[model samples]
Target chain A: MGDYALEVTNLTKKFSDFTLDDISFKLPKGYIMGFVGRNGAGKTTTINLITSLYHKDAGEVRIDGNRAEDDKVLYKESIGYIGDESYFHEAFKIKDIVSIQKDFYPTFREAQYMQYIEQWELPTDKKIGEFSKGMKVKLMFAGVLARDTRILLLDEATSGLDPITRDEVLVMLQKYIEDGERSVLFSTHILEDLEKIADYVFFIEKGGEVFCDYKDQIMEAYRMVKGGTDELTSELEKEIIGLQKSSVGFQGIVSREVGDTIGDKFLVEQPAINDIIVAFQKNMGGNHTWVQ
Target chain B: MKIVISNHSELPIYAQVKEQIKEQIMTGVILEGTKLPSIRQLAKDLKISVITITRAYSELESEGYIATMQGKGSVVLGRDNDLLREQYLRRIEEALETAIETARFLKLSNEELIDMLGNLIDDE
Candidate 1:
């Protein structure tokens, strides 16, 4: 038994067209880890495996130190999974969904549920089908928060949300972990939000673990190098992770350790989380310093 | 304490938090022995990650500006601490050096610069 709230060790899953490689990362209690990758990068596969929606071919998911196979009910009760799926009937209203969900989560707090509904202005009178996509996503968050789950698995839950609503959800996630006993694993393409709120960033590429470390550490690892076309030497080109060249200039991500080798003339800037993800895919193979 | 973090700043978010808190401590805005907000609360308030706040607080502790206790979240340290005084002295020197450089750019005499400094201190 470890101290992590959610631990995924060598989680491997296979499908007809793709395979989720040996992915492993531990999100300790009281923190939020952003699970990020390109569209087909197996982010959803990993989250699904963690939530037991998809049976993993290999690897174990331990929710608060208890495996899914150990105690089914206990494991399920400890975690809440919120994906883009509505998980509600088309004709059901907010109250109808609550009545059904109350039967499932014994730890459910109706007051908390009402509070979120009130805060988000979720319509209690309208059928679930009448809600907008963003509204549905907010409703999912409200429902999940009502269930006092120790670990939250969010898969693309914030994609449809508007900026204001997204910020609110981020704040709510922060509040959820204020007690230091809860943790969240949020997967989304919105790297900007993750920059402000994610403690750790677990990035994958083509169904493989690219890097999983503290958000600060990951940010510290790489730099964006921009230089004139005339300044691009063979040595400098080799140092770049995802080198791209145009008629006027060239820009790419380079390891911070590669700073000394890069001449003072080149413009070295901090790479954002999104920049790293995008540049990584442009790499022409060979540079693998991002591991660990 | 009021902390304004600029997303456009060249400094990293954690470093910004550390610098802002350090400034508040040195400037007497947050008095000594006063309790700082809990790391979680500050993160929530700032809309930043808890890890970033944790980093900022640890840096402050190591620099002797704040101390974290068991029950108490974090308390501002006294300014009399040698390390704190040294940091303040160094910052003051840096600020003075910048002022002198600007004065030189304007071709101001030493007497003129000192007179300007006197007026600024008087205004404060």
Candidate 2:
């Protein structure tokens, strides 16, 4: 039990091909936490572990101040999870899906569900099997929006959506956070969405936690430094966490304070989320070293 | 209005966004007095940071292409004759700066560069 809606301590999960090591992070109550990474970066693994779809090898997971493992039903009740793929019956109508989920979640709001269904313009009687990909995503989002779960875990929910649809989805999710009792753990390869909505961000690489912090802290604290390779000293290099070099020039992530200390010899640019992750991955030998 | 962005461009994203709006203004696509989208709407539309769009609008207003008021959103301020004249002078100054830099690189005298410019302008 903690102040966080979702908390993990030194979480580790292993598989034949990959392992999520020492993954520790938290989502503050009622805030949106964007779980960000590149492809196959163990984002889904973390979501799976949180939902108890996969058991962890080590560490702890708690949802809404309750141990996720100790109270399966209560944990499930508190969490509404949407993974990379869904298993809705194709032949089922949108109404049918709502009817089914209503039985599972006591707080499921039929009035709210109908309101979102109409607001999102979802096909009520139409079979979900016939819906477009964007429509399916909208349907999934609509379902989740109507539920009263305190914790939401969404994996790559807007990855392939068109700009307009993506915007709509983003607006929907942002509006979902109006109820301060709710929180979101949204994992996505689409970094732009996170840039807009996430209050905090967790960056994972190669099944390991790279960095996690408030979105503003990340934007303010790290900088991308560009300079001639010849001007780069070993001492300067030591201060950088992720150094990327090429024949033309070099770019790396350095602390904002450290970058200022380097003086006018280098160009210090704001580091984007993607740049930070790539630099960290490159520094880790194109693989990642767990920081447990 | 249509706007194009080059992936190869090194300009910061906010600058690109401002340039696009300015282009629309310069080209008469976004009419004077027309209400522009909200910062949130534009950010949502363009898939960029809200702060970026806010900065763009702020610059546009400072340059006199648009003005923003709370709740009413941003609106295109009709091109003032004086402002247009200032814009032209600004463009010429920018061209002069570039020409001066190139002349310095080539070690060309100011007179020589003026002669070259005369010929180029005559050719145009």
Best by lDDT: 1
Clash count in backbone of candidate 2:
0
Please give, for residues A152-235, the per-residue lDDT of candidate 2 as tens digits.
888887787898987787776655554445678889878767776677888888898777877656766777899888888998
TM-score of the candidate numbered 2?
0.65
lDDT of 1 by residue, A1-292 (tens): 5679998899999999999989988999999999888898898888878878789999998988999899888888888788876778889999888897788889889998999889878898999999998888888888888887889889998888789888888988999999888999999999999999999998888899877899998887788899999988898787788778899999988888785456487888788888887787666256655744
Structural RMSD, model 1:
3.5
Per-model TM-score (chain A alone):
0.95, 0.86
- Of candidate 1 chain A, the 10-residue stretch with the lowest lDDT total is A283-292
In model 2, the Cα lDDT at residue A182 comes to 67
Which is the leading candidate under TM-score?
1
Deviation in Å, model 2, residue B74 alpha carbon: 27
Per-residue lDDT of B11-114 in model 1, one digit per residue for the tens?
Answer: 88899999999988888999999999999999999999999999999999998899899867999999998878888888899999999999999999999999
Q: For residue A112, what is the lDDT in candidate 1?
A: 89
Model 1: DockQ score: 0.68
